[model samples]
Target: MRILLVEDDAMIGEAISQALKDACYAVDWVRDGQSALSTVHRQRYDAMLLDLGLPHKDGLEVLRVLRAKKHSMPILIVSARDAVEDRIQGLDSGADDYILKPFEMAELLARIRVTVRRNAGIAAPTLSNGMLSLDPASREVTVDGVATLLSAREFSLLQALLIRPGAILSRVELEDRIYGWNEEVESNAVEFLIHSLRKKLGSSTIKNVRGVGWLVSKGE
Candidate 1:
């Protein structure tokens, strides 16, 4: 899933970004509320981690504006403000959850999962396309009842493709989902990863759309 993290503290942002990446999330982090607002307005995200204290604009104002614009994306407040009134105000501002700073990474991740599931109206842990199944929580993939082990990048690539079966995803879009925005992308990285995934999953599972992009067919 994609997440936007709005945090001003460099150290805390780095830590949360790394943790979210480790959990296989596409994260876009901004240092201030203005950048965060710009990002949320421009791109789609599964959830948001917002910090109250921010430069340029307060995070509360950011949330308020988003709600005013009718952006229904799930938002979780992650702030150093632990006071009861602060939490109440954050929720009143339309935050889905409130998490105080110095929180456990595991707890934060758990909350994110809940928010994503709630937004997507999903109650299951497994996502499937035909006989192929993926367990997002376990990072496991199974094709036609057979378990297929994949490298981290390979798994990420397949997950991205499978999530939107039959939809053509451009190389740039795939790269954005598989690798961080700051990472150096090899010229043929997407092609290489697609080749590898096809080899493991089945040669006919993924379709190349000529010059357009790639797509996982709806059924085998």
Candidate 2:
């Protein structure tokens, strides 16, 4: 998954960016609300972590603008604004969730998972397509009830496919989800990941469209 992190605090931003990357998310971070808006207009993200206090433009204004423009990606407000009204305003202004500063990294991750799942209209914590199951929190994949370990990049690629079973994703789309700005993408990175996943699962686990992309079947 890809995330847009809008934070002004250098220390906090660095910590959050590293944590998200460790969890297999591609993150692009900006220090101010204007930069956030500019980045979103040009790039797509699975979700956004926004701070209310920002320079150039306020985060609330950014949120309203994105929503007004019909950008539906989930938005989670991470702010020091802990007042009751502040929380209410954040949500009312279109934030999917709110987290106060000095919060646990684990909690923040859990909330992001929940918000992303909610936006995808998936109610379960684990993602699955009849024959394969992926646990986001555990980063574990189970093939027909048999647990299988996967490298971080392999898990990332498979997770992107299983998120929307039966839907094919091209290399570009998969790369966008798996790599963040500044990360080097090798020439055959996507192909290599797909090959590794297939070997670990089954030869037919992922299907490739000769001239298109790859997909996991929607059902067994």
Q: Assess each prediction's global lDDT (C-alpha) against the native.
A: 0.85, 0.93
Error of 1 at 20 (Å): 1.8
- Which residue pairs show collisions in model 1? none
Give the runs in model 1 whose Cα sits over 4 Å from its true position. none
Candidate 2 per-residue C-alpha lDDT over 1-220 given as tens digits, one digit per residue, 9 for 90 to 100: 8999999999999999999998989999999999998899889899999999999999999999999998999999999998999999999999999999989999999999999999988999999998989999999999877998788898889989988999999999999999988999999999999999999999989999987999999986
Residues 112-200 of candidate 1 have per-residue lDDT tens digits of 87777667656666666686887776778898688876777887777777767778999988887776557688999999988988888
Model 1, residue 78: distance off in Å is 1.4
Give the TM-scores of the predictions, in the order they appear: 0.86, 0.98
Q: For candidate 1, give the lDDT.
A: 0.85
List CA RMSD, all candidates: 2.4, 0.7
Model 1 TM-score on a 0 to 1 scale: 0.86
Worst 10 residues of 1 by lDDT: 120-129
Clashes of 1: 0
